[model samples]
Target: MTITIYGIKACDTMKKSFVWLDQHKVEWQFHDYKKAGTNKKDLQRWIKAFGWETVINRRGTSWRKLPEDTRASMDASGAISAALQNPSLIKRPIIEGNGILEIGFDPAHWAELF
Candidate 1:
């Protein structure tokens, strides 16, 4: 399976994920949303696979920085729109491959998936 990891390159969690993947010799492509930008279709698919609540990084600074109204108005579609507009709003190190869509960085979870 072709693994594609999506996130900003400088994220600490993303760094850890990269190291883990490298240590495991997992061949994968890094999709830096900050540089390449996010695709609405892909984001929608991910949100569909793992609800907007799971795909969005509400704990992150990006989410916290959003206007109160924006945050309060968030629904599935709104969340997807926000994430597409600001890639940082999406959870880091979203790993996609082999019909799997894993969000965030959890070594234990990755161990099982890998």
Candidate 2:
């Protein structure tokens, strides 16, 4: 499968994912949202597959830094808006390939995925 990994370049988990993919001889491309930014369509797709709870990184500093009202008021559209405004609010290292869609960096899960 042709793989594309979406994440911030400097993320520690992203670094590990890079190494894991390399070690497994998986040829992949990086989509650094920090540079290129994520779009509403992609966010919508991921949310549809994994649910908003999985697509959004609620435990991250970016989420924690949001105003209380914003967090409290978050719904599907609100989450999409927040994530579009700040890509860091989305979970790191989302791997998409062919029919595959996954979030987070778990080496064991990745082994099974590939």
Candidate 3:
């Protein structure tokens, strides 16, 4: 199975996810959002797969730091655009494989993959 995990390298959740994959002997690719930035097309795809509410990391500092107007004024597309421009706002450990995408790191949720 081919997998791609997206997040900042230093993020604890990302680190844990990577370690878990390694421990399971799963082969995967890492997309470091800090360096790579979020892609609009990919974000749109994820949003479609998981829904914007699940894909966007509103709990992160990046989302909190956004200006009141920007955050409050955002429609679905606007929020997605913001997330694409600032990956820190796009949650951690988003794993995709075989056209399936999972957001966040819940070992129970990932157990099926292994």
Candidate 4:
């Protein structure tokens, strides 16, 4: 199974996830949203698979820093746009296997897959 991990390299959770994958000898590809650029289609797919509430990182400081008006006006498109511009707004460690999607790192959750 091919796995694609989408997140910034600096995230601790992402680092841990990567380590776990490496230790398990899981072959995977890393896509840094900042350098790779997040597209609306992929964001939409993730939102559909995981729900916007699950994929959006509202707990992050980046989300907290957004203006109230901006936050209030965000619909699906707006949220995707925001996520594309500010990748931190996305939940870290979004992983996909083929077309199957998983958000965030929980060893147990991933263990079920392999």
Candidate 5:
């Protein structure tokens, strides 16, 4: 399976994920959203697969920085729109490959899935 890891290059979680993957000798591709931008179709697919609640990174600074009304008013569609507009709003290191889609970086979860 072709493994692809998506996230900003500088994220600490992303860095840890990369290190783990490297130590495990897993072949993968990195998709830097800052450089490549995010696709609506991919975002929608993530939302469909994992639910918007899982895909959206409410704990992140990007989400926290949003206006209160904006945060309060978010629905699935609104969340998707917001994520598309700001890639950082989506969870870090979304992994796609091997008929799997994962959000966030958890070594244990990755070990089981991969």
Candidate 6:
């Protein structure tokens, strides 16, 4: 399976994930959402697979910086829109391969997956 890891390249969690994946010799592509941006279809698919709550980093500054109305009205679609506009709001290092989806960095869990 071809693995694709998605995140902002500058994020600390993404840096750790990069080291781990390289150390483990997992060949994968990167989607730097901050630079290249992401599409609606993939976002929707990810949201369906992982749930918006898992995909969105509500604790991040990107989310907190939003207007109160925007924050309060964040349903799945709202999350998708928000993430598209501000990729930093996405939790770091969402790794995916064929039939494989991982939302965050967990060394133990990744060891099992790898």
- Top-scoring candidate (lDDT): 2
User: Candidate 1: which pairs clash?
Assistant: none
lDDT of 5: 0.90
As a whole number from 0 to 100, the lDDT of residue 39 in candidate 6 is: 85
Enumerate clash totals for all models, in the order shown: 0, 0, 0, 0, 0, 0
Summarize candidate 2's per-residue lDDT along 1-114 as a digit string, tens digits.
679999999999999999999999998999999999999999999988888888889999999999999999888788899999999999998999888888999988989888
- Identify the candidate with maximal TM-score: 2
Which window of ten consecutive residues has the lowest lDDT sum in model 2? 47-56
TM-score of each: 0.95, 0.96, 0.92, 0.93, 0.94, 0.95
lDDT of 5 by residue, 6-103 (tens): 99999999999999999988889999989898998998999998898889998989999999999999888998899888999989889998887888
lDDT (Cα, tens digit) per residue for candidate 3, span 5-44: 9999999988899989888888899999989887888888
Model 4, 1-114: lDDT tens digits are: 779999989999999999999988888999997788788899999998778778889899999998999888877787898898888899989988876588899999788776
Across 39-75, the per-residue lDDT of candidate 1 in tens digits comes to 9898889888889989999999999999999999898
Models sorted by lDDT, best on top: 2, 1, 5, 6, 4, 3
lDDT of 6: 0.90
The CA lDDT of each predicted structure is 0.91, 0.92, 0.85, 0.87, 0.90, 0.90
- Determine which window of 10 residues in candidate 6 has minimal summed lDDT: 84-93
lDDT at 44 for candidate 1?
88
Cα deviation of 41, candidate 4, in Å: 0.8
